[model samples]
Target: MIGQISEASPEAPYLAANLYLDPAVISALLIEMSDMREPPLDTGFRISKADPELLDVWRRLIGLLDRPDEVPVMAHHFEHELMFRLLQGPQGALLRQIAGTDSRLSNVRRAMRWIREHFAEHLSIEVMATIAGMSVSVFHRHFKAVTSLAPLQYQKHVRLTEARRRLVSEHDAAATVGFSVGYESASQFSREYKRLFGASPRRDADMVQTIVDPGP
Candidate 1:
């Protein structure tokens, strides 16, 4: 998956929250709740305003952080309830596909996993298609439709993103980081890295380091 950028006013406090849904948990909930003949979801991503009920559920779940002892006893219940609320919301179709064993989204996820695992290697569309259990044509269309990126583009994203992380965390030289992420030409790597990140790898690494560990 790719990262999204967010902006906040300098004078305002920014709060962001994310919940990771386990497919296994969703599947279990589907079994206990109403029938799940949900329609196929085309896009793997969606943005919807949270209903009041869903917001309340999140509030209670986050509240448990202040009551750590109650977490062991009530966390599971809150999680299950959260999923139940999500299952009843506009993103229900997306949630359903994640739990479906043989869905287009799941199939695409299969290929995506392979790409992330082998990001530094040469990418083969045929191999990715096989992993997704779809023909190359169908796989390409669905993959792009779901992720808004072609397969190769996704791999490049994975590579450059990984390269940036390594540059900062591993403190590797720009050339070495580029090569480690599958670029044969340092110029090509620097060009693309700048295009994506708005700075050369070395410069970006330095900027991030300055922000993370400003000297006394």
Candidate 2:
């Protein structure tokens, strides 16, 4: 996103709205929204304005934040209304497939969940492809298309993120953190951790600890 912006261009304001929906609720809402059994596929990010009605619904939702007492009473109504507005919008067809059991998007989402759950263990791309119900070549293409990273690369990123998060809570033992995060070689872990974090694990941990737990 930063790379897409011009370095010399003036900064512009943007509103980022994040919708958090429960998986069960999402499945129920999405499946019911579709007229057929299978939900349609949707691509990744695109820029667009919100529907005028959705924009109004969104404003109503945001308005609740200021009325703390009304939130418990009215949050669900606003939320469902917002969802209703989105379902009638331009991306409605794409959003409907989110609940499909056998769509490519569903398959890739399952594969991603598997990776997050078993990030500490060694995994095979072939096995991952099987989990997604796609052949190796096909899975590779779709996985890259969806995540912009190959399966192994995705695993590497997940492992590193876990390692970094755990390091903040654990003592400053880089090798121990490395082994805990599934790295076979301590030296290789340090090298890769350094490559990703721009500093050795021990150094990065100490720097973070210093900032987060600064002395009086």
How far is each candidate from the true structure, as Cα RMSD in Å? 2.8, 5.7
Per-residue lDDT tens digits for candidate 2, residues 150-202, read 98888888888788778888785889889998999999999998988899888
Q: What is the Cα-based lDDT of residue 213 in candidate 2?
A: 70
Error (Å) of candidate 2 at residue 206 is 3.1
TM-score of 2: 0.73
Candidate 2 regions exceeding 4 Å error are 1-18, 22-59, 62-73, 88-94, 210-216
Best candidate per TM-score, number?
Answer: 1
Report the lDDT tens digits of candidate 1 across residue range 1-216: 444335455798566677788999999998898896868567888899999999998999889888999999898999999999999899888999999879999999999999999999998999999999999999999999899999999999999999988999999899999999999999999999999999999999899778766699
Give the lowest summed-lDDT range of ten residues in model 2.
1-10
Question: lDDT (CA) for every model shown?
Answer: 0.90, 0.76
TM-score of decoy 1: 0.89
